[model samples]
Target: MLLCPYNILHKAERRKLLHAIGRCLFSSWDSPVYFSDVVLADIFTSFAQVVGDVWLSLCMLLPGHSILKPHTGVGSRWILPTVMSLPYLIRLRQCVIEYNHQGNTHRRPLYNALKYASAFPAIYLSAAQGMVVGEGGAAATWFGGSHIFRLWLLAGMVNSLYSFWWDVTNDWGLDLLRPRSEAKKSESLRSPPRRLVLPGLHSATPHILQGSSSIDVHDPEGISRSVVELSVRKRCHALGLRHSLHFPLLVYPFVIFLNLVLRLTWSMKLFSVVNVNSHAGIANFCLKMAELFRRWMWVFIRVEWEMIKKSRESHTKHRADDGIDEYELIPSATIERTPN
Candidate 1:
């Protein structure tokens, strides 16, 4: 068992070396071993589906753009897309099942299955041209009675997208989107920090590492932390026991999600957005501005919280002259005075 761990550490070290070489060659060295296969599969599955949907949506726009009248016997026009969506949906089901089978604690099986189920209708709508308003459009067949039903259908699609995003990101672990090597490369590119030793008499010296941001100093062994850390880390690195995870591209998806939510919220206002001719650009802009204002408020609150934390820590951590902690001091019932 010990040898097994030792061997695993060796492999991790090899990955580290490969990561360094990849940086020199400017390639994705830190990508998961199966990353290329995953990328290709996603291209076929996700990218192809997106391309097909955009094609159909654009085809509908042909009437508005005056390109040509859309095809009669719409069934023939949509047959391929509808057929294609079956495999996409099947793949999604299989993926969720397989993920559950893997015994992933971080991802819930039933929740993922439900999310996938939720996404199916939206996928079907996009693929089958269900949103088009005329001549057996999905909206007409399902909710032609009133505009309220139509808005409800649109809300369902939005909810599907929202649920789908949450499932995908959380299930797959956003770190899988980018290679660990890339994250390390960015980490390595930062300037070396300068340590400032603050004057203090204690078990550990209170100091700061001078850099772009102030960092807490936890070591006081009178040795370079990096060297000691590397040695200990090398010994502790167990290949199969410890897995590496990193995702630098998560921010992009979050930004996209924020915009999507903003757009959806904009659509919800005044029910005017659901009308055929009305536009929601003004609402979208206003919501985006409101989101920015909220973010600014959050930043201010965080800064104040940091200040409060520091004040508390400073007053709480002192050691008494009697080698007792400041908190250990108790109220004495009687007082004694020294006479000179």
Candidate 2:
């Protein structure tokens, strides 16, 4: 928390900064929930990283204990995964709380919780691998046909794919699997999915703000259905166009590619084949740096997606106030609101 820039800001400034950060992390600016729950998860992860770094520093500073070697002992083998899993456990609990408290009509909250739950198997499997190698040594563990190695590989793959899918679909709002017609229907039928528009593209403000007859002050119901229809059409197309909204088009794809690569290999830190504490701890340093970069990209895209979603929701609400039945715009599901 000391490292976050929010510490230096005045109360008002801090509120603004926290709101933005909350959107990125939790997709909502519900202050109590964001500060108490979402921020707690992030803080736990930061502390875990700090603990790992401190451990590495100790390994380097006090070398007589053989702390720099692989299989340093039971404590060293288990500590990393234990610390790393703490944040996920916190997040998983939060998801369950939200699902129960708010009522899970769509089961979206449960699905989000499941994504966090997936991390545990990979994390523990890595620790198990380290423990096995400590007991049997690398030769027997790797070449002795140990099932742990293959099991760990399979667990890592499943965890990586699950996390990556959540990142792109739920977090980033890129429904890559749904067909184009499905995307169009989703956009038109329900309120537009919360999404960001590309930086260079036209603004995604509500039609009323753009000089469209979405609202006539004297007769708000006189809103042109055609105008609303056109707005929805543009928003549907903008979902794909906005992939590179904050950065250049090329930058987003590269970031996405890097995200996938990092996700797949994140468990490398736990692999017993190569000692992360060896080579002057270069492997540990590199992995930490890569993770930081991946998170930076994730935060950027996530905040943009949240901002767009908020905008679209506000627009929809304004229309509702003007006597427009937003649900009538499309033929399918009605927009439902979940309590914060």
Per-residue alpha-carbon lDDT of model 2 for 226-248, expressed as tens digits?
34645664554465533225555
Best by TM-score: 2
Query: Where is the poorest 10-residue window by lDDT in model 2?
Result: 193-202
User: Which residue pairs collide in model 2, if any?
Assistant: 194-309
**For every model shown, what is its TM-score relative to the native structure?**
0.35, 0.64
Per-residue alpha-carbon lDDT of candidate 1 for residues 259-289, written as tens digits (9 for 90 to 100): 4564345324322222223334676457546
lDDT score for residue 315 of model 2: 75
Q: RMSD in angstroms, all models?
A: 17.6, 9.5
lDDT winner? 2
